[model samples]
Target: MTDGPATRYARAARTWAPIDWWKLEARAVYERPELRRALAPFAPVEAWRDLAKDVATAWGILLTLSHIAALTLPVLAGGMLLGWLFQRDDLAPVGLTGLLAGIGAVLAGIGLVTEAREPTGTDPRIGRLIGGLHLVPSTLGLLVATLAISLGSADAPLGVVAFIVDVGVGIAYFVLNRGPADSGSDRGRRNLARLERALGELPPTDRARMEADAREAIDVLELRDLVGADDAARAREQRLGLLAMEMAPRTDLATQRR
Candidate 1:
């Protein structure tokens, strides 16, 4: 029999993707203690491998959103205008591809915003599962752009580059949301070796900043200190808080919830 999807997806998630400029950009979000201090966990740099994946996952969010805006506005407004002015209903939607792109772009924006919101709830695992679902249309417009390019083939120069970036992001989300079974309890503790490698790749100051962020994320979110807390209740607060930070981001929930 063929390998199960879990086995396969876990393998694919482990596979090093062909393009990774996004990982660098995501990591840069943590370059300074000033920036790190402002993060969801007070310093979410402490989360485990999956949350680590969250680091890589945010790369194309802004670019993808901007890319969709660039493509959609021109085609949507221009196409409608051309269709109306020339009295050719036939011109509307370029036979429906433009319409699909427009719809997908709007839905994709909503999905991406959901993906960006940090989880705030009694159980973060549930929030992560929901937030992960949002990554789809979050990346949908880019996929539509890829499809639009494939269907049109005339916009090759920029479209080709977007196609590659889209593929890289696809790889990222697959790894992030579809990996092997996870309790997500291992946020900071689950993937120590990989985190170490990532840490090793950083400059000395950047590495120092991560350490600082871990300490700060707890305070920023009003979580008790996990290691130093004297009792179970405080440690539970830290545990839940880190899980909440790892799961999602949106609308400065980071500042308001705490």
Candidate 2:
């Protein structure tokens, strides 16, 4: 009696296959320089460069929550400082009120910036306008900090320090979101390494079939940037693994009919 397709696939997967990685590595070592030289001409037009840009953009968009948190903390701290300034019994009401107003403007400006960058379906023009309003907070924070220092309020300085730290964090966050230019390449290498390890164990036909199936799924998932470097290979492997479960029952039904 002939085995079913699933049985055949399983048997193919368990069959011994000899692949000499050490020899491949040794060959690569010997030919590394020449191979690099041969490929140098195409380096300028590598497809990975464009892929890297898309990956970075996707990474940035995914980290919007982090960006919002980073920006929000400073605004909150500034609000507290303004509250302290107005509550001060020692300082004259007029000067303290003026300082409070300045802080208000700073908070409002940052709020606008936050709203602009908020992940929502808002009017693009309005978002741009709000984003442009960030200069208001940037300039206001400095001025208000300077004023607070001059006013002899310790709270204002602390608030300004938090604001500065938040700004620094914001910059770092942006850098991270942009990711390194080589990020996509690094991710690709890791994915390829993982897939090679996984499919290498399977027979050639099974391996090829799995690769084709997984590639289609990966393309669909990656469109929303869901499958990124972090655990993407594992996720792909899991998805492919699930395909066996999906097929197993169908195979059993076919066997019953036979």
Candidate 3:
């Protein structure tokens, strides 16, 4: 929820001609004060910074589909597999009246995980205790759902429901996951292009000054020479480029803190 360099990039991306602004680096080299000051006349930097916190909270709460699916799909699929493997013809049709109670259980586990990690610290000890308590029911819900389906009690009910849930979860997963995965390198190039275009329209003097300031700032802030480029530290800053905002919420916690 804190307003750091990541927050600035995320918000600035939205205003910068609908590009995948999240591609902007959180490091000071990309978030240099001089570059920001140069662009401030074109943006509501303060207002966006204030909204950055809420936006980040919203992101953690709504993590697109990839992260959720990683944890949920396996459980749901395992439930279906168990149900199919153990189904009985003797089960009542009335039990088939509806078919989705099982789907809700997956939410229980992850929801508890979110609140514990939520950014609040008024009472650390109490928070930790309460957070752990949430897991009891979280585990219970999944356990019960698993048992019900696999034992044939919820098979008829969840027979088709499993497919629905998995497909829905699958489609959501794929759509959300569809984006550049590199550490914004590609996006960084695109952003650089956009910035270049903007600068192109400016007078030579102002453009020179702004570029000079940004270059100097990057020179000072850059750690490229300071640190070795191993080519495999492995960081991925998330989401589709142009269409990212359409499918996923802009307030991504993972990205906002990048």
Choose the strongest candidate by lDDT: 2
Per-residue lDDT tens digits of candidate 3, residues 153-253? 55354444433443343343233223432224333233334434444455556544433433332232223332123311111222111112222223322
* Per-residue lDDT of 187 in model 1: 26
User: Which 10-residue window in model 3 sums to the lowest lDDT?
Assistant: 231-240
- TM, every model: 0.26, 0.29, 0.29
Give the 10-residue window scoring lowest on summed lDDT in candidate 1: 16-25
List candidate 1 stretches off by more than 4 Å: 1-194, 202-258
TM-score quality measure for candidate 2: 0.29
Q: Which is the better candidate, 1 or 3, if ranked by TM-score?
A: 3
Candidate 3 — which residues are off by over 4 angstroms? 1-55, 64-69, 72-159, 175-213, 218-258
- Per-residue lDDT over 180-249 for candidate 2, one digit per residue giving the tens place of the 0 to 100 score: 2221333223333433343344555654554454444334334545435543354345433233222122
- Can you give the lDDT of residue 194 in candidate 2? 39
lDDT of each residue in 97-151, candidate 1, tens digit only: 3344344345444443444442211123433333333333324434444444455
Clash totals, every prediction: 13, 0, 0
The positional error of residue 15 in candidate 3, measured at the CA in angstroms, is 34
lDDT of all predictions: 0.34, 0.35, 0.33
